[model samples]
Target chain A: MSQGRERVYINDVAPRDGLQIEKQWVATADKVRLIDGLMATGLARVEATSFVSPRAIPNLADAAEVVQGIRRVSGVGIVVLVPNVKGCERALASGVDEINLVMSASESHSRANLRMSPEQSLAQFAEIVDLAKGSGVFVNGSLSTAFGCPFDGEVPQSRVLGFIERLLELGVEGVTLADTTGMANPAQVARLCEAVMTRWSQVPFTLHVHNTRGMGLANCLAAWQSGVTQFDAALGGLGGCPFAPGATGNVCTEDLVHMFEQMGVDTGVDLAALIELSTTLPELVGHDVPGQVAKAGPADRRYPCPAGL
Target chain B: MSQGRERVYINDVAPRDGLQIEKQWVATADKVRLIDGLMATGLARVEATSFVSPRAIPNLADAAEVVQGIRRVSGVGIVVLVPNVKGCERALASGVDEINLVMSASESHSRANLRMSPEQSLAQFAEIVDLAKGSGVFVNGSLSTAFGCPFDGEVPQSRVLGFIERLLELGVEGVTLADTTGMANPAQVARLCEAVMTRWSQVPFTLHVHNTRGMGLANCLAAWQSGVTQFDAALGGLGGCPFAPGATGNVCTEDLVHMFEQMGVDTGVDLAALIELSTTLPELVGHDVPGQVAKAGPADRRYPCPAGL
Candidate 1:
């Protein structure tokens, strides 16, 4: 657990999470180029691709090739998403450093998103943890829909806690509570974090929040107050919950890192380099990404405000 | 002194703070109509106009007439901005219940916005406070450019606290710390609020944060942690910072209130009513305002998502 507060650990997901939600199919080489560019920016971690079935996510069908073709930077850790045991095996073959296992908290959301119930997902998580442990690979579990579910309105706090306990028992190193539907308010976040912190004081928790209800950063602050430090954000605010309505963008990684570093909290990531990486994204992904900071630049960068208005 | 957590005080500013930066000159009757509509929605405080010189702010030249035309609703407190002693006298004559006095913390911003040095502006603040006290009118002082200034880059925390101490010495009842250039990062906000709260434990402070750097909501959460509750926001994200580059909107009042209420924080204002009031704004102001909650509807209010992206 590298808890040296001097730097922020940026997990750039421009290749995996950023491209997965787009309607257009980006070429495999373009994906590799984007990943290479992100790695050059000194981002500590990068999610390269998901080894899910091609029939489900056509955009990431070249997941294996993207991982194989990219010129890997020496110090950067390349992580990939896995759906099931087969997906985990595929990820191991790609020669990645880490594995991210995702499961939904709400039964309704789990069925809709991953096509599994809560019990089945928990069983899968245990198997994934066991597999990673045997192969000497690190495992990070994501409890999606921890905040609220689009299919099922409100997920009980106990359910989220229970899932965390189960994942901890499975020997997962870290956990991320995701706002899959962006239904989290600060108070709910505060109350839940306080409860979890009271019990599992040493558990490493990360926040993966969406800006759907416009409380992404606020929710992050609430989690921060409760002693959770790590945050998961997509560069350029790309990626959306295909099932979560109107929840169309992740908290922009550049924007989050900017806010953190400016506050004197070190995320160890370079914002200028991240902004530069953002510039080449539109050509790579086909359409412009939705990050406001990327398009408008930082607070100091000036632009021509419309005349007279 | 009303610390009853259930009763949240909402001070509507569509007429004064909201209209000052607007490029279009709204008619006096339309302003009155907008105020009337806002009042009908159970609002207690509505800022009617600024008593500045006609040439200085052309949009609010007919300040007195606008205030006088509105049939002041029973129990609704009409407030107006008073730039100096003369403005205070004029606002009192216009039959407003409260007077708002503002001065920028940064010297450059104070000169650009108020045409006075910080010392001169504080002198004006003292005179206005005295005039309001003599006339039995309530006075609320605002420290603009408290967070960060567009001209001077980051405004020091010491300068902001020093200004607050000066206002407290002047017997000002309430104070608002404004992000005039919208350069507030969450950490900066948290550190400043802690400083203010540690020094002045009893003084009530309101945050008038702008969304220029996209940290408006994050700054709000930081303040919430520091125990400062009141906030000033425009409905429809109406106003923009005259100095911060591309900073073209205030934090939407409905959005702020919604986030607060959802977190069980008791911001007594009605979100639905605020939304309805936002809809009537375009016709009254002769153009559309920039609030997203009004256009996108509330978090729970969902629309049918079209076919997959």
Candidate 2:
């Protein structure tokens, strides 16, 4: 019905987004191991680390080391999150494939999380884009809080589009619309994605959703129906910005992949490998993670039939 | 966009489906209180209890008393699950607004769960439908495992439609398609629901989905998009058939309602009241329930802003 089977690209952000907010420090070796496991799953893209200030996010203090340590899988594009020009330098120095720049769509969120206004953040992005233009490493601009903000009840769509306009003008290769606080509904996701894709039809627009209100996958379905093929998910449904405390984290990568593949949509990533990696998350993070697929198993997974039958 | 506001009916099955598999024996008073609370949430239909062999499901042994003890809310239809003539007669005596009859769509499932062949099950339904015809009680025929069965890997679409054909011929007033073992995907749900609705256009077709593999709401969305309106959900997602041991509970009523209502679809139920009722479930059941809204709060629920912001 949707033409032919669509291949959805999963951009795993577990190592970077997941562990960044964790109070328990994941050792650098473990970080590399998790990234390697994800790479072996045949994912086309994986966000391995964030080059943010060590003092700000101590959990990812060994970002550059973790990036350098991973055994790069052939054909897998490695990505790293960068907060500023220093992070950009660090990521470029690590030979990353993509440099993901972060900024908040809501001014209140920008002030609380990044301590900069949207305009100031975009001004900084211009310099980063110029630096990455000839570095062979593409820049992806992520607009956080694109849906709604905790401090600001509703973010105007015009405000989000204006920021996207500025990011495109800065020559960023792509954009990721993030539901930072999980304040999104299926209808809202469909409408916004359609509008954005209408203008940026060729540029890849990924949906970075959270499961905070448990609409992460639902929003993804809506977005996919609206022609979005790329998604940002963490390993165990882990990670939420500290500023947005109650946000559940990104949608689980394995869970998302399982649902898509079972629906006849191709996610390219190997679910068995991802699920095996998912089982090790609790031990790796020193606490249980919140993903249902790993515990419940995949959709087609059958249990022993009733004994008598 | 969806013709102004579309109203979707949510049938609360926490009492019948939710507590039926719960190990803890809830007091009759608590059952009545729960039904009453659900009534106050403006739900139009609620499945209060199931009258089955106590030997089979001891959890709902006090079905009759519990059904009669509930304080009826005006304009709300109270339904009960009935297995046989005896159960139907008891439900009639208790003055139930509707009688929900269930039989598995898969032959293997019917044999293991209902311990009868599809032919034998339909033959029994004839007498029950005849009894309900003149008694002014509506009979909702529920076909469990309509999508997939654990025992029989994939239940053919032909098999499900055959059951629907027999049920409709048996003089049933409505039909409900259930994903008993949670072995349904969005594509499968959309295809089956579309086929069934196309054939039985005007019937009050309902969807009863499980979150076993976390595809409950996603399947519901697919079904909804395919024009299936009525849905059966449990409060706090408190159910799983014992015979189908690992299968999760029905979709969470509040979660589904929240998603639908937020998408500009009217469910005619008060989410705040439903959420308040969800908070009391863990204490009522003596264990935690599987619902996100109660823990994470609603999408609009806001937290205190950071100091600077």
Candidate 3:
């Protein structure tokens, strides 16, 4: 564990990851408004959209328009998920500030998710990192299904560490170990984080957790204790993996920030403003959201008199 | 820090603490049925019912009858929460195997919640423990708002330890440090649990966590690393503090057991049965519960169609 006060960096993933799995098609303007609202809460980075083929993720069909339509507010960096060299080109053209490359740590999930072997995925990562080298955009390599795989069962920690070593060598600015299938617990998270931090103490790692088994926050706490602070969260917990059947959305950003702030750990995000943004999600996405604190307010807000309703 | 394997004990609190906060009035027989169902989940102990004044908590008006009606399932110890000597007398008369006496660590919350000072509450604990000693009933002294209190703002760790020292002097089994409003983060939880365990390593401490701020499981995981094993959870996260505004339930038993089981920790509780219990809670309590794992299956179960729900 790091020997000082922990600094928490929250990456809001509402626009891209949150809505990608949604069957409903949200408008480009709504997506822009969502990113703007998320930025207004003091989050420095927001995953604005995915630069992928529309046929692959039809929910994010208007990625380019959504990116172009958003008013570039200062201090808010927009990031996009790029699958390969083609997606990286689209992301660079969209003027995004950062690009995230994802591959599964589990071989079975890697094959099913990206349709490539582990070595091929590593090669793809190298290619994308090389392309984005001097593009003024940051790179984050995400290792999905880092805890356990739906198809391959429990993934060995050694394999995940090997992938991280390769990605770090590729010169990616950050790495995210995702509980893609929501199979992580505190022990596994602690063990994995210990292994990773022991080898690379200076490597910045982000946690992408899901509340599928209700261990989302627990696993997150384990990682925090092990010195991983940056997190990817969905507003209203509005995303999930289609490959993992029972998986839910990413850990709710508002809830995570609330927890951090209450304990005197500065998240630099306003809880009340985040709650207000949470209300705008339903109208923007055309569906109710899943986050509990947004629907229920913060921990100490009193319920209004029943007659008020 | 705990050495070797840590054995986890689950304390089901759905019957007493859970039903007390609901607006709907459950019948006495239904309360017994809920208790029976919880006991069948193989919980080491189940909080049967509270013997508080009906005017104070109308939901448990028939608390004595409900406690008397539950079949004494073999190997399951019954626990009941008591506010004073009178409540403890009634609980002991109802054949409760354990008596849980609760007081807030924060004086402000104690005044609002229990209508007493911290000193007055500890004095009451001394009397209650003295009375229960001759009856062969175990007493667990719980300090609410141990992490942070709503009215008092931040509760200092020293105040919690002082309460523990005073309570330990009384004839009680152990202390339960509660995050009454879920204001605990991983750091705060780890610090508090470490301090407490360092002092009373052999004492039977349990964590009574609420999910109000979404740090319930995180705090639980921190406590686990600090050597806490016994936890008090409701069936479907169906309880909240009667006095603390906007508070949610205790960590759900099914959710907690699922987290531990996925991490390879032995909880000795069944998740499938807990989920079955979770589904029936809405019907029993006259409203839907807050647990996500029950509605969403375990993370690995695959639905027939992976293409979006």
Candidate 4:
């Protein structure tokens, strides 16, 4: 039997990654209410919004208003995705607790998504880190398509490791390895997570996986068995990749918490509260979200015997 | 890293378990075609149909015709669920390779689903075994609610082991531990699977799981890591429990095969062929199925860069 971690930390990225691609415009008030509802559920961190170009992602245009409107809890971290030094400046001015810088591990994905090469993205990240150095805001770097790219089939583990080294050297405090297109399998997740946990023992690494192919929970189980203590999930499984159309988004937060809690691991989040919050997502997004626990209830839920049986 | 089993065996139970719960009646020819298509995908076994009372499960009322109409492939076992000596006689006369006997481990589930106590079910199983003893037919006993039950919250592991011992003593050749309500978590699956593997080293054990709470693939991963090589899956994630309304049915066969194959474990089945067959399920069932690989494609599927990127 594998000696899995005893507890896990989860960052709900629904407000940012989950909503950025949505066609309907979520009002600024509704976005704040959603983030605050998530925070009330005791999430470790909430990726409130992304301070990217509004022209590129019009849905999350009110990133600053969202960050400023949320009821900041003392222990909960409010994170926002920042694209460059300009976005970083906006996020810091909004009094965010953490600034999440973005980059891609694959060349084609880097060009397609960010409109910059990997090297160019790294140079921008270095400038953002320098800008946020003395501001006391935690710096997290999210490496998109770290597992595989839609255009470029596989991103080598050695290349991912090299980028991690560069990100840390640029004064980034934490790193998130994102399976942007839901291409990661359990064995591969275990191998890569083990490699990072072994090499960067002191650095905190988070796994961000999509459920496009239905291996989301299995990949999370593999990563947990390999000693990963932090994860990135979206409420109602809300995020999707523009490149992989018809694909589901990140692993659902309530479902992931249900799995871990059922396995006797502590996630420090109220599952019932999370599920209750997830029910309002359809109205918020104008469509159904992919979360299952909310629809199916938790595993511990019992049913009455069939009538007359 | 877990030294998981090198190869896995899959039994597609869509024809029996998946179709039995459907609200619409599936035509016998379509059922035969589905089973034949699944077998042609190089599956190790296919549960063609069940010989239960038509009043209880009308969808599978054409059991004998389904068993006789399917093109028998060499090296692929054709199995059927037999509820009593009558079902066993019909299945044996139809020239099936295996007869599956089922009973619930939980008392409430046993009474509610099968309308019999555990002891009564065991007695009936012994009678069927005696009837099929000299027919050269393999006896496979399936213990439903082996993990947890909807009416009775948790089924103890020790109680499950006792039932397995009884099934073996009754001349059962193999056993399937079923999570009837999708109540199983990965830790529970790992513990039960490891116990069974350690105690009954020679007996072939199959895991039957549901995706009700979204832990289906995770539970499969745990069971696989605990030395389980045989799995029971339904094509297109068909099937649901009558007790747990709104719950999804058996784990998707195509999704499971995709996961195992992507992990570099040999499943001995053609995944692309399986997915191709999954596309026809919506038209056959008159509804969209829940399998994701069929919707999103496999992990290795590549896409061209977005226009102008």
Instruction: Note the residue pairs that clash in candidate 1.
Output: A7-A267, A7-A268, A8-A267, A8-A268, B236-B291
lDDT of 2 by residue, B144-249 (tens): 8898887677888998999898898889889999988777888899899999999989888999988876678878888888888889999988887544444347
How do the residues A152-228 of candidate 4 rate in per-residue lDDT, one tens digit apiece? 99999999999999999999999999999999999999999999999999999999999998899999999998889
Give chain B TM-scores in order.
0.91, 0.96, 0.94, 0.98
- lDDT (10s digit) by residue, model 4, range B187-304: 9999999999999999999999999888889999999999999999999999887655556789999999999999998889999999999999889888888889998888898888
Mark the 10 consecutive residues where model 3 chain A has the least summed lDDT.
A300-309
* Candidate 4 TM-score to native: 0.99
The DockQ scores of all candidates, in the order shown, are: 0.29, 0.57, 0.36, 0.76
Candidate 1 regions exceeding 4 Å error are: A1-8, A241-248, A282-290, A295-309, B1-8, B243-248, B279-292, B295-309
lDDT of 1 at A160: 93
lDDT of 3 by residue, B106-199 (tens): 7677777787788999888888988888788888988898987766667889878988888888877878888877666777877888888888
- Cα lDDT tens digits for candidate 3, A56-171: 89988788898898888788788899988999988888899999999889767777777787789889888899889898999999999898887777788888998998888888
Predicted model 3 interface RMSD: 5.7
The positional error of residue A112 in candidate 1, measured at the CA in angstroms, is: 2.2
**Every model's Cα RMSD, please?**
4.0, 1.6, 3.5, 1.1
lDDT of each prediction vs. the true structure? 0.77, 0.86, 0.81, 0.92
True contacts kept of each: 0.23, 0.55, 0.41, 0.81
